[model samples]
Target: MKKIYLSFLLFHYCVLLFAQTPPAQTWYQNSDGINTSVKERWNEDENGFKHGKYIRYDIASNQIKDVYFVKEVGNYSHGKKQGEWIGYTCCNYREESSIISYQGNFLNDKKTGIWKEFIQQDFLHGTNIYQEGTYVNNVREGEWKNTMGVMLGDGTVRTYAEASTRKGFKTIYRNGEAINAYDDKGIDLIENDKQENLNKTIETEFNNCYSIENYKNFRAKYPNSDFDSEATIRINKLESEKQKLILAKSEEDEYLNPLLQKWDSMPDTSKTVTFFKDYYKEFPNGYRKDDVKKRTDIIWNYYDEIKSKYEREGEDIGILNAFFQRYPNITTPSLDEWLESKIEKNASVYKSQIESLISKNTDESLKLALSKLDVINRCNRLLHNSYSLIFSIQHSLLNWKLGNTELALKEINIHKNDIVDFSSGKEKYSSVFKKYYKEYKLGYPNEKEVWKQILLIINQ
Candidate 1:
């Protein structure tokens, strides 16, 4: 309970200290600075350049929160510090107690225009000991009030001794030196000014920018910068990755569009014909979209009508295969499996017929093999049933070797090259190859012979 109460007090104290400074955000690296220990704590723009309000804190101190960096913040443009910046002397800052140290305008790294410097009698006591006049380019000019109490810019008059400031004198200044000494209270503070650092920062500028346009802009602005060569290399890498994503999306659409189209044709589809009509009305010149008219139950019923004619006569695999060749894109897994089964059944019946004619060495068995090969090529080849089609190819070739002159060399010529695509090493291709091999086999093809024939066609 004591630890919890102490933590609540510490949280509120730290919040008051950083109220004018950066809130509870994160810190990043600024490797370009002369001092290695100074860290930049700010957000970056698209090009990895430090943008917006920036604070550079000294991590050299061992303390968890350094007292000097409480409110010393400035604006950063193109990763360079610019505009009005406030600097503080060391230790804790409580608004009622902490005095205003030195506030001024910075042009990159150089101090310019009016500035104020403070001397505190006691640290964090909110007391200003002395003052100086206006400055033009790091030098003092005009009249300066030499009072014991410092009249703060926020209409607060404060001194270590309460009523001792009303009886002070004035001093005149030229260049950076004082012409006349007014009193012995405040010492001359003109030579105590620190050097300000500012210039184009994008010019050790990839932690600099995460976007291509920002890197390009950096290159354009600082064409002769040392990082220009590396920026060009990064741009090329980003572009190459972008093109690879485009090609991958195109391949995905090729497989996906048919599934999407077939799915949309169903009556209970989530986005049906009415959805497309609404979309077409919204985007008249939409990509690859054409005018679609409303249709009734005629489409799916008509497909079923065609399917009926082939399967009615005790499942004619040849005519059923021709139906698939005409409408290859529309079928689902159930329909594809059904057709492959029909082909396997037909092939089994014909295999026995061909074996009976082995002694005869006739053209009749050759013609039967050639006809079955045509049916497999038209139907299963679309889905690339490698084992099924490979069996048909090797069987037709063996029958041709038996001296039956019913030549159809086109089956061997076409599929030999095309079947190699199924060996893509994807699980989908591997599953299809295994499925057909288990279901049907006429002339057995070993792994080596199967791959050899598939590749040999490519070279030819």
Candidate 2:
């Protein structure tokens, strides 16, 4: 019982010792040309190690000028720092306008978990040096983000602002050693500044030209630039525009050549209905469609005059022949048939006139004769065999009169096979002109034999 009582007294004494409050303590010192002060509860463990909250400050200046301020604020465990800690700098002793330098968790006097470190350039701007990842047993592990920034002036003056204009990079750390640092484009952040400068240079060059060759040259110089994709898009657009311009120029040139060479210098008399007909047939959707219409009106007026003259004069062979001569590809069947009957009834008179015209021996005269024969054949709607035979015979006769036997034979041979092919078809007359076949046959009974003899002459 005495031993139990003595144990109880000893236990009460131990409780009193453990429950005593530690006195508040303060200390001041000068270092690095600045005065500093620390205040805390002088609590200590049995081993005489500090415990509980601790605070520190630089008192050299009420405003932060050259000295660090608010150095640390954190708790302690058996003299080792632990739990959340904050280290910041301030311009005032009252902690006004303070810059948080570091803030994060601690364990046994070692930094652990997420921690951020900042650099204060001025009162309002700061740079985040790093935002580190988790710490395992005081060793940095996993990813960390780092950033850097610079102050921007407003041309006339400078002002402190939040350091939001920062470019960031990611670094992988293992045991507090960085394994890799890279940006979003996978370019090494260590070399990012150099690459960024190069990109700016390329952009300046590109903006000056905005051409495909310019972009292509940029790619050639900086093959690994971050703006490669953008450059490619620009090149495609520029090349497409270039091709469109080339095609437009080609179309313009094509339309211009024929206008200058053929249509511009055509004679008034030559510009009959046939001239407009051929023009529309060749250039149906020409760029000068309005001009084509205007020119066509001129030819139509001439055609109206010819038609009126023919109706009033009752088929003067000379005037009828002249109209047909001008437009060989055109046919007026009734007018052509009336002229044909007039020629046959007065063969001597018509032949004399034709011989006089032929005596000139010009290309225009030859073309006119060929044109008249073509109109006659078309008006009569001759069969393919009969039409070819009659046209060839007439063409050959004209060439014979011109003493061009070789050219006449050349023309005959060119149509020889076509004539043979048609004769084998058993239709001696064109189906559309079957009613006129008897008159045609009577005019040329031995046309096939005649064409065959001409072919023999040509082959010889």
Candidate 3:
């Protein structure tokens, strides 16, 4: 029963101590000599720098004030300290005491760099060091630890490893020990082994920023130093690829309008009709689909005019019929496929028939047909599926006129190349195509090939 009562009493006392709020400190006296007092209006001390202590004065209130930091002892004007004033930690209306003994080096009146404090054994209670501080007004204004407390910009008063601030929270620490600190999520900010490495790296980089010269030198010395280097390289590469994509977009916009104009003006010849037919197949998503359809409708209207004029009309007519027979799925074969199938066999016959109707046909009909041919050329370059059989045949025809007879013949035989080599486009077809386009270029190897080769470089 006695033990239980003792435990209960101890718990209550601890709770009271933890909840205790220290009273605010007052400016009671100025050993250095700038006057701030309940007796007088306080003002800025102009001689603060010379005296080494800034403002000083006293509070006469009955309420106990916190500790005051005094520099030197003497009467000072302009609210500054004069000769040798000592610093003390006073509490309970100045009845309690804490003081540092100073000797040796003094720069002006302030302690230069390192000053050691000696305390009575009773004050330390078995420990070598003792420290404490308090708040005044909304600021963390007070005499701190055994050492002069440095007022942190964060509004916290620093006294050795312990700190208290405007927020009214306190932390206590032993001389040579560590603690795991956590945020609201219970995430350990310092001692968690899993994320400690990442945290340290981030902290180092952040601190490096304040030391610009050292940071730059470190980066120059180690180009691929850490994750930061890899991220920098990736961002640079992405920006370069984006620039290339922008240039490709500008090239695509150039031929769109002129091609539409040409399609509006053509005559219904086999080549003109075939051009628009392929144009639609290649560019289903093109802006000119309606224009191609309109031009196609005009051709059937004039179909009868050519039918009656030639003795060899039947031969040309058979070719058109063959196109329908071969591609039953094509509802619209722009050049009457029947006419084109017969063109080579009945070329001389069709020529004579065209001559007979030359005077009767409008010049607009001939001009429009020529324009349609041009539109088809531009569409094939920009939008066609160049790997398809029809595109290969067209490419062959175009290359034949450009005097590249070898490439023209190769294009016509693309199916044979695909059959002989299982790799097709990647191996046989690409080899043939690149020999003409890629090999001739300087300083730019096929990067895909180079990467593949690099992987196999160490193979036995």
Candidate 4:
């Protein structure tokens, strides 16, 4: 009985030990169907959580043998990264040393405490790149020093012997905010000292007799300074006083000199109302004030004149182009609104005239009406008018009326092709065009050949 109990106890103990041990997993670094090397090896618990040391290898090929440089070695607990982790980059397995990219501790999968980054100088040497201060919950805390290197391309060379010499800025950050910065010679780059000197210069200028030029010079030199607004206000007041004194002395030209110069530089073709309003404000009683007011009036009247001309003359491409060129700043939608009204009216007139001609059924009258319609269509196209269905149906009807059977068939076919091409993927037919198409199709049943060609083109 004693032997039997002991055997049972030993079996239970073996089972527990086997259950505690994790299963090993191996991964390979393969490229282009070639198994370069063993990339990673680690162990996971029964829960599928990583629970042991993880190892990564950088694979490199050489004539003699395949090299596996240890790239990262770290520990994990229940799939959460924990404890010390070290990472290397730009490494050579055949050499004695490698570039330590980062070395630090991880707590519950978050980086914590100080971390040191290094620039690999050579196979056996590395310079400290930066020293990160302590981190709390992965947020950097306290002072941190980051050193920059002079060499541009990542401080690495193929030979690994001629590495970049460190010559660059050193910035100091406190709690993630850069507090101080300096170059290689240790000159402070935050410019607090320079600002103090600039402030002194501005104070000296202000102490002298009030001069507009001095204030202007100060503003130009230190445009971003805290005193900039104060300098600007002083300059404005002095200039206003000087202008009043010059006007009082009956030298009105002195007051108008700058305004006249600005007006002379204005573009000859088009000027906005706002430009003249500003001129009027600057020189309300000057010699050219009336002229500026007249220019403002002209600009305000220009849009109205163009609108009236467009309304009276119908659609004219030349007039439309001239309106846009003159009022380049004006938006197209306003013009489009006006033009759309005129276009609708023209379309109505054309439709009425075509219908009247079709009812008369006299060839001479029909021919004259067709010629007028053709001219109208040409003008509409030149103006970028969008009445496609009306134009197509007009051409088809005119051809059918003249007994040009093939031309009428071709016109309807073109219209169908356009509809198919335009009505793709979420695009529905235009309501106006759809209505016109239905009317033409139903009204022209006697012209059955043209209708058949249209149906065939649409179906195909």
Candidate 5:
């Protein structure tokens, strides 16, 4: 009798626990109790003790997106949500036909789980049928792929991209490597094949110029050929070059003499950008420095005037050609200039702020600087919108460096969506942000006072 009583008690407790536990509610089911005029069907469970299928609704469209049905309910003849439920984006009852669809199980008046949907069958899914769908929470989820090849907007069959993602990257396999797919942008590249067709263009140019005796005769024989205009232009450039050739040796000598002398006197690696830029200015079209064309921007960045002038011009092609062929050293001067300016600005702000804090109190200064530094640190931690990240990081770094790490970190954390992880689980940030963080941490005794030790390690 005692054993039977104990067993009975255990069974009763289990039953009570199961009965008290509530079913999971779909995100759509959490609506407030008011139904709009356009709402086709709106029902909420009124029974104080009801548990299964608590709410059901239909809007302008007969399309069902959300439903709550519990299979456990043996019978509620009045209903356990049997009919289709529709949804719509209502403009005060306009009843837009473009309603999103949802199909699935519902329990206890809440979407208990998975739901399928149909978005307009706009694009092809790689060898798969496409339809739109969503999960219970109304979050966009589901593959529209079917088993047959279908063409995308570009007239090629591709594994369509997720609606929320960029289409440039296409899935080639279930996991790992993806094949490169071009969108409309890829269509434009087809014209680039014109370069390969230039043979006829070149032949026509040669005949018109008559640079080669035989080709000139050939053009004379075919006077009305389609390529006459092109041939004429090539002929003109060649004649101009032939006339200019007489001055080439003298001009070449003038350009190369100074550089040759300087290069001989300087050490190979010690030959700085400053030395090269001065050489170029002295010999504007020099041939000798063309060999050491790699170091020109080092000097260019140091000279704000020249760098600024190039940027103000805003002619990238001109800038590239001017520096690359004869002065390859200056090719990336713009980038160098940008980096230098940022560093100077940041350094100046940090120095002035820290100095002011020291005048008031050493601890206050340290705290302010630390906070600014942390902000910079956090901003660098983000990957979205590089410019935004740069500003955010700079703001935080300035605050942390000025002695307010707490506030800086707090502000930067607002961009939580920007954080990402690499395959190695390490964070990748903008180079400038990384550089500043490393410097700031090393500049003082941080929480762990590891900067000094790190410096020693670096030196050793």
Candidate 6:
């Protein structure tokens, strides 16, 4: 199995390596040569002085992306911090981490202007604590505000933020003089020493705060404070993390519930146009897509079958009708109209052949005419269950010509009840009978009297 490795490395190769460092760990030392969470990658002059773009971050594990982010980014002008700097929190806990935390400005290695830290989230779900204030020559000055509350996320810099439960501590400063200090709750901590001795523990494991200045101020105000200070002040935000939860599925449920299983279980013969069309709608991609490519074969396979039948037997209305019923849109020809035209053509062919036979009749000619008439009658009955009176009568005449009186009677018996209603003056076939009778009388001058016997047997 190929393992995905965390990609990050401190490489300098006239180097423009996209995105990340190698999976191997490399420690980043703080200003005091102590391994702090901060790591740095920046351009430096020939004398090893930081210059050009500078970036640093603490690496964390991300399930969605396996890459090292260049977190704290700023510019360095010849070994001196310059321009804007943004710091990000890191190290994979709970398979995720906050993308950004703090952004501030630096001028000649000194923190200046406004600075804000965003994420208060840690290794577990937690609250948000943020700091926004001004720094003059590396000294916290002007109106500095530290808020302990909650906020989601936004872009680069903001003049204000909305937190759900916001409690801000503000101190107004003028010419290096701390004039007033007040929190949102109006807690007068300035000149009020009551909270100085409050819940204080320097034990790093409790993971309380993440501000060095905050803890240092605590230690200064209350020297006897037993509060923790193992840089957990800076690490406390990591306590709140987002854990990726996945519900394990049973093997049977996992395998059988997919659409793929449904498709596999379907019979190949049952894979009709309607079935495959619905399957395409269900699974528009992947294996279904590959199967759709086989659609040409499937569609042509069916059309080819119909074509073969059409070639062998020549236009079976029953087969064409059944085909049109199943697949109406497969062919460009309107099958309904096409079938109607074919039936009319067949009917006309039968009419012409029957009319031509009236001129000269033989046992062989009558036999062939009867065969075609029987097929035409069968097709009409199969399609609409309606009797073609002329075809039926033609069948009887053929049998009468062959001297098969009983079969002639058998042939006319089935249409007996409907024959009168079928051949009534109101029916379309009545005219056909009249036209055929006018010509038919010339061929068999005894056809009228013979038709009388035919009629007698049909009614019987």
Lowest lDDT 10-residue stretch of candidate 5: 88-97
- Per-residue lDDT of candidate 6, residues 1-460 (tens digit): 1111211222221024224443232347565667655465666687877788766654544566554545666788988999888765553344333344678889999988888766644444332546677888876677766565212121112122433346476666654455555567665545343243234233432345445556555566556545534444443443332111111223323432564456467654344444455445544543335544565366557666765776586765445544554454443335334555666566766667765664467666767776776666654533332336766667665666666667766766665555223323444333444454455543543556777875565445
lDDT of 4 by residue, 1-460 (tens): 6534533453454344334432378787787898756777788988998887887767566688665555776899999989888886644444423356788888999988887666654543444564445666675665454454221122221111111354455445554444555555675554544555668877776566369998887778778877778888989999999998777545545555565567567664545455554545655656656655665566557767766777686644334445555654443456556755655566666667777775675778668667656645543432333454556556666666677667766655554534312333322223333455565443443556665665565556
Clashing pairs in 4: none
Q: Which of candidates 2 and 4 reaches a greater lDDT?
A: 4
RMSD of each: 27.2, 21.8, 25.6, 27.9, 37.9, 25.2
lDDT of 1 by residue, 1-460 (tens): 6534543454454456457555234654446864444355666777787777766554223335334343366676767666887654433333222334677776656666766666554532333535556766666666665546333333343343432443343445667555543444543323211111112354335347767887888788778766779899988988888788677657555644664575457544232223344445544644335223323233345446656865685656677665655555544456556666766676656556544543344556545655665665566543355445555554545444543313324445454344433465433323333444344333333445653553454346
Question: What lDDT would each prediction earn against the true structure?
Answer: 0.52, 0.55, 0.37, 0.59, 0.41, 0.54
Error of 2 at 100 (Å): 1.3
- Which number leads on TM-score? 4
| Candidate with better TM-score, 4 vs 5 | 4
Off by over 4 Å in 6: 1-345, 358-360, 382-387, 400-406, 419-456
Q: How does candidate 4 fare on TM-score?
A: 0.37
Error of 4 at 130 (Å): 2.7
lDDT of 3 at 130: 29
Worst 10 residues of 4 by lDDT: 154-163
Residues 72-158, model 2: lDDT tens digits? 667888989889987756533332334567888988888888887766645433334645457777876777665542111111211
Q: How close is candidate 6 to the true structure, as a TM-score?
A: 0.31
What TM-score would every model get versus the actual structure? 0.26, 0.30, 0.23, 0.37, 0.19, 0.31
Cα deviation of 355 in candidate 3 (Å)? Answer: 47
Comparing 5 and 6 on lDDT, the stronger one: 6
Sort every candidate by lDDT, greatest first: 4, 2, 6, 1, 5, 3
List model 5 lDDT by residue over 1-460, tens digit each. Answer: 6534533453454344336444343324334674322211222355533334332233333355432222122212134543233331221112122222334554544443444433333212111112222334323233222222223333444443342233332212111121222232343221222333455765655545546454455558657666655556666776677777646646767766667577667553344455555556765655455564644544444445444645686532223223322333332455445544543345446546654554454555556655554333332322134433544555655555455556555654554335333334534344444565665552432534433432333233
Question: In angstroms, how far off is 411's CA in candidate 6?
Answer: 2.2
* Model 1 whole-model lDDT (C-alpha atoms): 0.52
Q: Backbone clashes per model, in order?
A: 11, 2, 25, 0, 52, 33
